[model samples]
Target: MAPLASDPLGLAIDTTFDDTSVAILRGKREVLANLTLSQFKDHEEFGGVVPERASRKHLEAIQPLLAQALTRAGVGFGELDYVAVSTVPGLLGSILVGLTVAKSLAYLLARPLIGINHIEAHPYANVLAHGELPFPALHLVAAGGHTLLIHQTGHFQWSIVGRSVDDAAGECVDKVAKMFGHAMPGGPAVDRLALTHAPAAHRFPRPMLNDPGLDFSFSGLKTAVLYYRRDHGGDLEEGPVLSAFFDAVIEVLIVKTLRAARRFRPKAVTVSGGLAASQKLRAAFEAAAAEAGLRLLYPPPELCTDNAAMVACLAAHRYAAGRFDDLTLDGRPNLLD
Candidate 1:
């Protein structure tokens, strides 16, 4: 089905971490402009995002990005029907920057304000890109701060069935890359090296694969990598080590996600979050979904990472549902489902 030609416009702000982004969406189907300013260089020397530094950068970049989004969308402040911001499950300082800006916009423009859960907003990114999803879907969100398996029964109804007990998939990847002396935001670096390099004779352990429940545990897997590096004189080839590491992680993710799919028998299996951009993981999931005779869905690479477009898309749905937050809305760093 074709998406609507025009719908109410919404403005979204996202500063959950180092990425400062703003997006303008028309209803849930059309994205007019989505802009993100990465803080990789700012945090590269520190090896990861520092909360204070991330917040400072967000303050510097939010206004410009917001203007760009609105200008590119050809929409005025008064034209916006709602202002949305990601308000939970992120660095407190970073979340505050975006939320503050969004609140000011909402107040000045007299537009409805919506506070969105950063994690919940991720799966909806697929909906924005691909029209609509079949109901009763299973979604896997793998990112730096979260690893969750969710069951979506309707527009706003969600149930978390599984999640990580320790480090998230992206966090594990970054930690492994850092151990190998890779630069900050190591997930991409590790992914690139892993794809190009062949696996070594050694095989990394797949954590929690044989566990009875769907919960994940990657800390042990990460520790195993550290031990391997120490035992092997700490000079193994980057390609092979990373290749093996990614293999273990992807295998565990696929096995657990497929297990949940089998239990629930969902119409579709979806993967989102920063790590969901992994080519190897995506290939594995594609095969798993096919084997299970279920449809597979995911956002594009750009959408897989943190972006305000997804926030705006979810806000549109919330707006229609009459879900609005007052000026007292506050950032929630440890918010969970």
Candidate 2:
């Protein structure tokens, strides 16, 4: 639907890593247009994103994507009420490209600028797609670079209760897939292979499952896969190996997340981020949340990955709160405590 003439429009830009994207939101609830330029093919030969290459690609794609998003939304630059951009916890060079472009647009248009936390924005993507989420929600942000279990008590208020101590879940998937000679951005490939293959008789260890706290560790599991390949003469069937690996990873994520859900008794359980698009992972979460009698929410598969829509969705709230940032804002590559 077209945005009403009176509806306020917000623009969002994100290039924290490989995905260069732009989006427009009408008020807080309606998405006018969301465009993303993926760099997966560029990084396929490298088996993962190359920071320098990613930044360069973002620089080239950001302006074009932004124009396309605005055109598709049927909104002009002067019509935008706010500009939001993801500015942290990502590749430094990549983050700077989007942040710089966003700052320039906000300045030229004299619009309010809002800086978004990439991780925080992921959960809000659900809010944008659906309506307001049930408060006190347990959110799992599982992506290539991060795996966090966050508890949201109110708008813009979050507490991270669990995090990956080593390789994030998505990273583990990629590494394992690379070991098996799978393509880059290997999570989806591994997931698909796992679905077709039966689990091997051997099982990988579930790290930190018995621990009494809410933290995650996948390095050991990744290593186990590596050693398994070596011991099996590096000729193990990909299907069974991937199936066992996928089961191990999914089990840990489900168990730890459910433990947190039960302990906190959140009204809803939300999962977002690129890996959240995994059909297998979503199924496991769906089953567990159902058993726990908690509502489960996730964005559409498109929103599950890195995109500007989540940034804009989050900006809508911050804008209403009168939160704005000045031109001095800079990219932060580390997570905020």
Candidate 3:
């Protein structure tokens, strides 16, 4: 079929954190453009992401990125059928930046506006990668900000079975990487180092694994690493220490998620979020799924991080379900609330 001006389009904006990302999609999974501008360098010197700086960068980068997405997708505003934004589970100011722009566009273009939960939209990344999510599925979301295990019975019908009681898995990874003197967003660095090295002789404790529940706690694992480095810095290399730390986190995640899958009897299991980018974790999951005789899925590394394509894909479902939001929709900074 020939492309037509009348073809409907969807636009997604994501400013949930330090990155400003815009995505354009035709229908659901057909992503045309996903332009993201990373602002990690601006906050890297601060040792962590500064919320105010993240918000300012979003305001500056969003318009240009939106323009680039539209141009790259070869679609104008007139073709837009809906506008979507990651509106919650983020810094208030940063989420507001994207939501305001989305609302204004919705009003001007008379298109439907969909406010997506950043944490919830993560599973949609898998949906974008693999069409039609299997019902009665288990979803482990290990993004930097949130870690939740969702039991999904259908679209928009899911309940959290487990969540981080303290530090998120991705946050633990970043802090562990910073111990090796890497920058703030150091999960990638840790992943690279972990790949090159074997697990350390020092075995870190897997937190909450024996608690008879699905909840997780990585703060203890992180503190164990701190104590190990302080007490025996000369005893181990960074590569091995990092490997052991990551393995601790992965064990807790995998064990708890698999436990939930067995209890819930889900048809398949899915992993999403920033930590899902880890090849080691993916390999471990692949082996576990193979052994357990269960189906497993995850988005590619690019989709694992903060991006609007997931938001857009989730919004496409909402649009089809008539789940449009009015201009009065406001930002909710608290992800759980």
Candidate models: Cα lDDT each? 0.85, 0.86, 0.86
After the best TM-score superposition of candidate 3, give how far the Cα of residue 292 lies from its true spot, in angstroms: 1.0
Query: Roughly what TM-score does model 3 have, to 2 decimal places?
Result: 0.92
Writing each residue's lDDT as its tens digit, candidate 1 over 1-337 gives: 1222246689989888778889999877799988887623453433342334343488877766676677789988888888999998788998998999999999998878999988889998899878788989999999667899999898889988999999988899989899989876688887787788887779899988999789998999999999999998746787898898998999999899989988988898889999988887787789878887889999998999988899999999988777889999999889574
**Candidate 3 lDDT, 13-118, residue by residue in tens:** 9888878889998888899998777623454433343434343488777776777688789989888889999888778898898999999999998788899988
User: lDDT tens string, model 2, 1-337?
Assistant: 2222345689999888777888999878788988776533454433342334443488877766776687789989988998999998888898998899989998998888899998899998898878888889999999768999999998889989999999999999998999989877898998888777888999899999999788999999999999999999746788898989999999999899999998999998899998888888888889888888889998898999988888898889888777789999999989864
Order the numbered candidates by lDDT, best leading.
3, 2, 1
Q: Is candidate 2 or candidate 3 better by TM-score?
A: 3
Give per-model TM-scores: 0.91, 0.91, 0.92
lDDT of 3 at 222: 85
